[model samples]
Target: MPEVELLLRSRRVVTPEGVRAASVAVAGGRIAALLPHSAQAPPGAAVADFGDDALLPGLVDTHVHVNDPGRTEWEGFHTATRAAAAGGVTTLVDMPLNSLPPTTTVPNLHVKQAVAGPKAHVDVGFWGGALPTNRADLRPLHEAGVFGFKAFLSPSGVEEFPPLGPRELEAAAREIAGFGGLLIVHAEDPGRLDAAPAAEGPRYAGFLASRPRTAENEAIDALIALARRLEVRIHILHLSSADALPAIAAAKADGVPVTAETCPHFLTLTAEEVPDGATEFKCCPPIREAANQDALWAGLAAGTVDCVVSDHSPCTTDLKVPDFGRAWGGISSLQLGLPVLWTEARRRGHTLHDVARWTATAPAALASLGCKGAIAPGRDADFAVLAPDETFTVDAAALHHRNPVTAYAGRTLHGVVRSSWLRGRKIADRGTPLAGPVGRLLERA
Candidate 1:
């Protein structure tokens, strides 16, 4: 018998290597130890044994778009973070756009913190925005503790956060490099975008044609070149076009500091399958054809793609219109990222280890959160007990996000998240949050 604060035992515990029967000991909100199932709990220790369910590390989503402060009606820290907790995500990094004052300056970062400090149900970190006008503010924002800076090479959906041009990209990269900060880019060339046919109507094909793979490839090519020349770290966000994989791979092979993250929408949904007039499936750098989707999975399996995150960018129902061309582009999947990814991954013969690495580990690494993603000593004891084979139909209205609009509505997804624990306490039960918000605002050092 060993003394510990709490013991969570499961027949299938997801470890770094793979799943096995283990008992995890928690003390002072950190995992104090991991022992075999035969290990006995101390006399005063409390233990919860999950018979057939799996004990998994709480997911760390690094690409969520919690449009708070100015756009709280769209999504806010309170609602979004609660949804994350219900979904088994104990940590998430919010994107810097869609809010009134995008987090391009230190003051803007402060504003975000003020809004989120008490509202977050799971630990929330922030990514700052990089616009041409804010080039001078990048260093201070980085020093102020943003995980990284997000820049758009093409027009950001919201006008407040304008995209960075080639010159601006160079300037921003230089500034970020000086401070040793990371820059995550929404890679789509405006030149190619201007050349593509004008988008209008309900045709999914027309929409897909307007944002082709060429745009992604062209933008990545330029960013990779610039990153190499400047010796700066660049991350490509929400990679939907598989045509850019070889270049990304070659860049990594050539020692360029570049990484890419693809979203659950791009991996699971495709343009060909989307019904006409369904704007819920709409997202920027729109989901491509089946072949492209397959290539993206290959990129993930081959290690060309660094990770998978839920770019859980959501808006009001009115914003995601019945007209595909008029709808705001984003997917509301904060609460379904794990299930969606698990359903798809298992279908492809991949293990839960892959899911843990992609959703939990890599995202934490991107945020520079050293103790949040894994189930090991010194790491935070945030975890989930999952019924991997259980199925549930998605009910958008039942979702905890402010807006009930979602692309995954009505879909029968595998892998039910039975309960989510944040720092050794259960925070989720059937989509309702049970805690009084134990989450903190994480500022990257």
Candidate 2:
């Protein structure tokens, strides 16, 4: 028999089949077996019994922006992964932009890995950038093991990573398809947006109106058309507009090989709640109204939206100017995604299993992280011990991210994460000091 290293027993264990009482045995850093809840641990195995607390598969967030290397002041690997571990996220795929000398080439990727390799507290993977100038660098970067390429259809905020033109977009799509890789896009029509009123003020309404849903809808339509024409896989990132749902559903039904994701802010917060001058709530695709939030929920239930992730883009607090339009556009919720989503999801009559699927399973499937997302045998021994009934108010200063500028400052949330384990080792426990760096840099398999 294989040497059993650890055995975790829980009254509520979430398996792919269903939630049930079970004991998970781990050996060689992978799940060895699923035994009955009362099963005896092997002689040499370390046992952790979490009575009544739910044991869930660690979440896989594929849209995090750990802007390290050149942009460590914004958010670095140590801070970001520590925040991730605290939120029950064992694995995260970092977006390629925001960092200086973005991951647009193999050498740049190595630079990031060199900085992150020793500081990461959880498993980290990278996404390559699809800039107009990097067209020739795609395959080499793919072969170097980036999960996929990320491209923006509109101004990317950072001048170095320019938005791809229509011709450039199609060319990148064809190149990515040629290599059988995926292209994840930030879909927003620049033409419509430039024509729309410019955002400029402390008023939230002006910012909301500046980025109307039609921009997202038009971009999705164009992307769907491109995906169909090129026979490539495309993923829409941080989809905040509900009006694009029907088109996404239709395209998927016709087998267009496309998928989309939304963030916790889009699911929980609303335009109606955002107070004036609260620029911390600003993001690229502005959060819509409550009815639109309802439509987004419906889209999730209807399988139009594939997953939910924390687009945990963080910056210095000073950068979040009182002006909504001029402030940095991102939300810092890396350490709060689980509880925030759980609070809203439970209220909507959604079960923990549904949360698991959206937060872990679907993201894992999207990035092809085959071994990282489930509790089944042969999967990595990553788990989150969540106390479902516990509750806490959000305190931005207490968060693990480098900056204390979260939009969830005073919100109360459910599902407290007591501890998180990565590869059979405890990386985060509520009040205890975290263990040393045990995370590995992952490559596409």
Write model 2 residue lDDT over 213-320, tens digit each, in one string.
999999999999999999999999999999999999999999999999999999999999999999999998999999999999999988999999999999998999
Q: List the residue pairs that clash in candidate 2.
A: none
lDDT (10s digit) by residue, model 1, range 85-126: 989999999999988678888888898899889888999899
Query: How many clashes (backbone atoms < 3 Å, residues ≥3 apart in a chain or on different chains) does model 2 have?
Result: 0
Instruction: Indicate the worst ten consecutive residues by lDDT in candidate 1.
Output: 1-10
- Could you list the CA RMSD of all candidates, in the order they appear? 1.2, 0.8
lDDT measured at residue 370 in model 2 versus the true structure, 0 to 100: 94
